[model samples]
Target: MCSGFPALFFAVAYNNPRDSWSQVVPIRLRLLRERFVVFFGKGSYGRDTLINTLGVLFAAVIPVAVLPILSRLYSPAEFGLFGVFAALVGLGTIASTGRYEAAILLPEEDDAAVSIACAAFLFLTAFVSALAIIFTLAYFIGVGSVRAHSALIGLGVIAVAFSGCVQILLSAAIRKRVFAKVSFARFCAALVSAFLSILLGASTQYAEGLAIGVTAGYAVCALILSRVVARQYGGVSLPDRAAIYGQVKRYRNFPLFSLPSDFSNTLATNLPVLFFSTFFGSAATGYLTMFQRIWAGTSIMVTGLGETFRQRAATERQQTGNFNRTMRVTLLPLVLLSVVLCATLVLLGPKLFEVVAGVEWREAGVYGQILAPFVCLQFVASPVSWSFYIAERLKLLAVWQLALLVSFSLSLFVGSKLFSAQGTLAVLSCVGVVLYAIYILISERISREENKVS
Candidate 1:
C-alpha cells in the first residue's frame, strides 16, 4: 500500500512544489499499476493453479524422462526392484510421520491441540514399528539366507520418513501463513537431489541408485525445508503437558476416526507394488512404476483443476451449499479431454514406448494405456474425499477405501499369482472402478449435508 516514494525524495531534493509534482507524479501511478498486477497475480486462484500444474508437470516428467535413460542402462528387474523399494519406503514414511491431522488441525486451534498431541504420539508408535523392522532385519541377516544391505534400506526409510516430517512441517508453516522461504527451500532440495543422483559412486545397481537418490534427495529436502520452517516458526515445538494428556484424551476420536482413514488412503495409493512384489517379482514392479508415472502425470493436470475448484468452493460454500457443483463444473470438461488422451495412448502407446525407451519398456507402455481410465477416474475422485474430511465425515470414506483395497488386493493377488502382470493390472482397474463409485456416493452425501445445513 505504500506509494509516493518518488514524491517524497523529489520534494526533499527540490524545494519547488511544481518540480516535485511534475517529476514524481507519473512514477507514482506507474508504481501503483505494477503493484496492482502483483496483487492480482497473487490473489487469483487461476494464476496459482497454472503455476502449481506446471510444477507437477515438471516433477512428473522427471521420473519418466529418467526412466528411459535408466532403463537403457539397467534391466527391468533393476527398475522393478527400485519400484518395490520405493513403495516400501513410502509405506514406512507415511507411518513414521503420522502428522497429517496436525497439518489440518494446527491451522485451527484445538482446546489443547490434543489431536496433534495424539497424532505425534502415533508417529512415535510408528517408529516403534520401525524399530521392530530393524531388529527383524538384524536377526535375519545373522541367520544367513538373505545377504542384503539391511542398513542401506533402513537408511532409506529413515531419510524418507524424516523428509516427510519436514515436508509436512513446511505445509503446516504455510497454513500458518508463512511463505517467504518455502519455495526457495523446496527448489534447493530438488536441485541438490538431482545433482547428487548423478554422482559417480553413489550407487552400483539400478535399485540401489534409486534408493540412494531418493534418500539423499529427501535428506537434502528436509534440511532445506527445516531451515525455512525454523526461520518462520522458531522450529517445531513439542506439545506441553496438558496438551499431551488433555489433547490425547479429548481428541482420541482422531485415532479412532482419522487414523484408519489416513492409513487406508495410504494403502489404496500404494499397495499394488507391495503386493505385486510378493508374487510377480521386481520386474513387474518396474512396469507398474511407469504406469504410475503416466497416470500420475495425468493426475497432476487434475490437481490444477481441483485446486481451483476447492478455493472457489471454499468461498462459495459459505454462501451456497452447491459445492458438489464446483467439482462437476471443472471435472466434466477434463474428463472429455481424458477420453481423447486415453484413446490416443491406448492406440499409440507401444509405438511411443519403442521410440523413447526401446523394447525393454514396451510392456510398460501397454500397461500405461490400459490404466489410463482408472488414472483419470482416481484424479477426479481424489478431491471428493476432501469433502468428507472437510465435513468431519472422514470415517465413512476411510472405511470404503479400506474395503475397496481389501477386495481389490484379494482379486489382484489371486490374478497375479495365477495369471500374469496384465491380469493384476486388469483387476486393479476393476478396483479403481469401485473406488469411483465410492467417490460419487461421498460427493452426494456431502452435497446432502450442505443442503440440510443451508
Candidate 2:
C-alpha cells in the first residue's frame, strides 16, 4: 500500500521474463523504495526536510511563473529603481530583529522561546522607528535630494518590520516541526504578491505599484503566519519585563556579532546592484536584478534547507554532540544537483530565456549562464554555512562575512575598470565562486573540529 503498486504484482513469479509485467514492477518498486529511503531516512534529511524544500519550491515557483508578464509590462529602467529599493530594504531587514529571531529555537522552554520572539519583534519596531527618525531628520536638513524616494523607503520600512515578524514566527514553527503551516503561509504570500504585482503592472504606469504589491504580499504573509502561530502555539504572549530583559541578555551575542555578520552578508549579496547602477546604468542594474529574481528559485531552496538544517543540527549537536552527519546529509546531494544544473544552464540559459521570458530578456539569459557557476557554488555552500552558527562560531562567521564583503568590493572595482557590464558580471561571478568555495571549507573545518571534541 505504501508503494501504491497493484496487488497483482505479488502473484507473479520470475520463472520467465515473458510471463507477465510483474518482473518490471519489482524493479520499479525497488527503485522507488530506494529513493524513499534516501529522502525520508532516519536523520535530519528526512520527511521534514522534504516538506520544507517542496514548500519553498512551491512558493518560489509562483513568482517565477508570472515574471514574464511582469517583465513585459515594465521597463528595465523602472525595474532598476525597484532593485535599489529592494536592496536597501533587504539590508535593513537583516538588522531589524538584531538577529534575535535566530535564537528562538535554542531555548528549551516554550515560554522562553516566546519571550525571545517578543524581544525580536520589539527590537524590530524600535529599529525601524530609529531609521524613520534618522531619515526624516536627514531629509529636512537639506539632504532630501540625496534621499530621493522617501515614500518608497517608508514602504520598505514597514515591509522590513513585516519581514522580521515573519522570520520570528517561521523560526518558531520550524522549531515545532510545523512545516505545513509555514509552507502554506509562504505559498499564499507568493501567490498574492504575484497576482497583485501583475494586476498593478497592467493597470498602472509606474514601478511603485510593484513595490507596494511586494510589501502587501509580505504584510499578508506576516498576518497569515501570525494566525497560524496563534492557533498552533497558543500565540506568543508578552513575557514579563524581567523575562524579556533576561532573554535579551542571554542572547546578546546574537545582536552583538550576528547582527553585523548578517548585515554585511546582505550588503555583500546586493553589491552588484549598487555597482551596476553606478558604473553601468539603471537599465543594466535592472537586467542584473531581474536575473537575480529569476534565480531566486535556487536561492529559496538553499534557504529552506538551511532553516531546516539549522534546527536539526542544533538538536543533533545537543543530543549526540555531533554535527558531521547533518553536514553530509545536507550538502552532498545539493552539490551533485548544483553541478548538473550549472552544466545545463551554461549550455541553454540564453536560449531558454529568449524562449520563455521574451527576446528582450535574451541577454539576461546570457548573464544567467555566466553567473550559473557562482550561483551553483553558492547554492551548495550557503546552507552548509549555517553549521558555523549551529556550532556557536559567531566570530568566525563574522570574519567570513567581512571577507565576502571585501571580495565583492574588490571584484566590482577591478571589473568596472577592465570591461563592460557583462564582463564585470563574469569577473564578479568568478570571485563569488572563490568566496563560497572558501566558505564550504571553513564550515567543514568547524564541523570536523566540533566532532573531535565530542
Candidate 3:
C-alpha cells in the first residue's frame, strides 16, 4: 500500500504539471543543470579549471589504474616505507626552494619574476647540499631508519633536488599561462613513474625501487618544465645580482612568513604517517598511506581547480584589487562536488578497495570512510585558502598554520594513547573537520575584507 501510494503520488504529480512538486522540482533541476553548464562553460573561470583538471585527470589515471598491480607486487610495509620517504622529500622540496617559487606569480614584470625564480634555484642548490650532508651525518650516527634505508634516503635527496626545481619551473609556467605545457609535463612524469615503479617492483620488492621511480618521474618533469619555461621566458640566463637581491628583498615576506607556514602545514599533513610508523607499525603506516594515495587520486580535480584558482585569483586581485566574487562563486561548486565524492567514499570505499586492490586493502578503505568528512572539508577549503597569499595575509596564515600543527599533534598523541589505530583516525578526522571548517571561514573573511578595502 505504501509503494502504491508513492507511485500514485508520482503519477498525479506528473499528470498535473501545475502541481507544486512537479513545477518546483523541474525548475530546481533545470537551475542546477544551468549552473553546472555555466560553471564549465566557454569563456568562464571554469574553462581554465577544466583544462587543468583534464590534465590532472590524465596524469592521475595512470597511477590510480596501476595501484592494484602495485599492491599485489609490493608489501604494505614497503609502501609504508615509501610513504615516509616521499613525505621527507616533500618537506625537503619545500625547504629547498625557501618557498620563493610562490612569489613568481606575484610580480608584474617578467624580469622580476625571473629574478625570484633564480633566487629560488640558488636556495635549492644550497639546501640540497645541506640535506645530503645531514643525511650522511644521520647515517653515520646510526639513526636506525637512516642507517637502514641510507640508499633510499640518498635517492630522496636527489628527488628533493629535482622536485624543488620542478616547483620553481612549474610556477614560472603558471605565470606564463602555459597550462597545457604544464599538463603535458605532468602526464609524461606520471607515465614514466608508473612504468618504472612496476618494473622495479617486479624485479626487486624493495621500497627503494618506489623511491627511484618517483625520483625518475621528478627528473623527467623537471626536464620538460625547464625547457618550456626557458623558451617562454626567452632563455634562462642568470639575472644580475642586484636584480636578484632587489626582488628577494621585495618579496622577503615569502621566505620569512610563507616558508614556515607551508612547512608547518606540510608537517601537519604528513605527521600521521610519521606518527603511525613510529608508534603503531609499518603495516599500519602502509594502510594509512594506501588510504591517502586513494584519496589523493580522487582529489586531483580539486588540486587542478586550486592551481587555476591561484593563478586567476592573483590576476583578478591585481586588476580589480579584489577577487571576492570569483572566490564566492567557486566555493559553491566545490562544496557540492566534495559532498558527493565524500558520500560515495563513505558508503562504498571498503567494498571498492576489496574488489579493486585486494582483501588486504579493505582496512585502508575503512580509513577512507572514516576520513571522508575531513577530506571533503579539506577539498572545499584548500582552493580558497590561496586567498591568503592573494590578499597578502601571510601573518594570519602563518598563525592558522601553527594552530593547525599544534591541534593535529595533540589529537594524534591523545588518540593514539587512548584508542585503537582506527579509533585514532576517527578522532583525527573529527578534529580535521573542525579545523578545516575554521579555515574556510577565515578565507571567506579574508576575501570579504579585501573586497571592502578595494
The TM-score leader among the candidates is 3
Query: lDDT of candidate 2 vs native?
Result: 0.83
Task: State how far residue 287 of model 3 sits from its true place (Å).
Answer: 0.7
**TM of each candidate vs. truth:** 0.80, 0.83, 0.84
Ranking of all candidate structures by their lDDT, best first: 3, 2, 1
- Model 3: lDDT equals 0.87
| lDDT of candidates 1 onward, in order | 0.63, 0.83, 0.87
- Best model number under lDDT: 3
Worst 10 residues of 3 by lDDT: 1-10
lDDT of 2 by residue, 97-150 (tens): 989999999999889999999899899989988988887787688586447777
The residue ranges of model 2 lying beyond 4 angstroms of the native Cα positions read 1-45, 141-148, 233-237, 299-333, 390-392, 445-454
Question: What TM-score does prediction 2 earn?
Answer: 0.83
Worst 10 residues of 1 by lDDT: 110-119
**Model 2, residue 338: displacement in angstroms?**
2.6
Candidate 3: residue pairs that collide: none
